[model samples]
Target: MSQNHTWLEIRELAEALYCSVKSVYIYRDKNLFKAGTHYYSVGEGKLRGKHIYNLELCRKALLERTAKDSRSNETYDNKEINKLMTRKLDNKNLSYRK
Candidate 1:
């Protein structure tokens, strides 16, 4: 993901990851990702809180979890996932892009 990209809301992240919002919450509870690293909470109203995820860190967390799960036969090509995530972030002014 590019530096210019904005934080992703939980719903946006769920959509990007092709998972349900509940699954995202489950992943959080399971410690698949950590707060302030993979995600952070935002104030919605006077007392309401909402979550926003860091796209790059979320991708990193998923990669790490997949690496540590020896019993899982699922295989992921990280390059492809990275490309897709970067595209979803949609940062148009990336420095490396000419």
Candidate 2:
């Protein structure tokens, strides 16, 4: 949100981020990016105004979201692995008793 940072139009941002324009709008609509910080509208109309985004802030938010998702996935994978290991150990113990 700093004045030194570049603010880009939705299409430009989408291109810069390697995503579709619709995805950019979805981020805004879903509140993934906070208004007045990551993006803001300009022009003189209620529904016709265009939104400009702070590229850096948007990137940061996206990175943070991705990191959170990956962490949750890792936790789920670890739990599954642990369950499989425990099952294998139980089977091995049964074989030993036979």
Candidate with best TM-score: 2
* Per-residue lDDT over 1-98 for candidate 1, one digit per residue giving the tens place of the 0 to 100 score: 64754579989998888888898899899988688778888775656478888776877788788787865776569998888777755467655835
lDDT, residue 34, model 2 = 82
**Model 1: lDDT to the true structure:** 0.79
Give each model a TM-score.
0.59, 0.71
Worst 10 residues of 2 by lDDT: 89-98
Off by over 4 Å in 1: 1-6, 44-48, 71-98
Q: Model 1, residue 68: what's the lDDT?
A: 78
Candidate 2 clash pair list: none
Per residue, candidate 2 scores C-alpha lDDT tens digits across 31-62 of 99888999988989577588899998999999
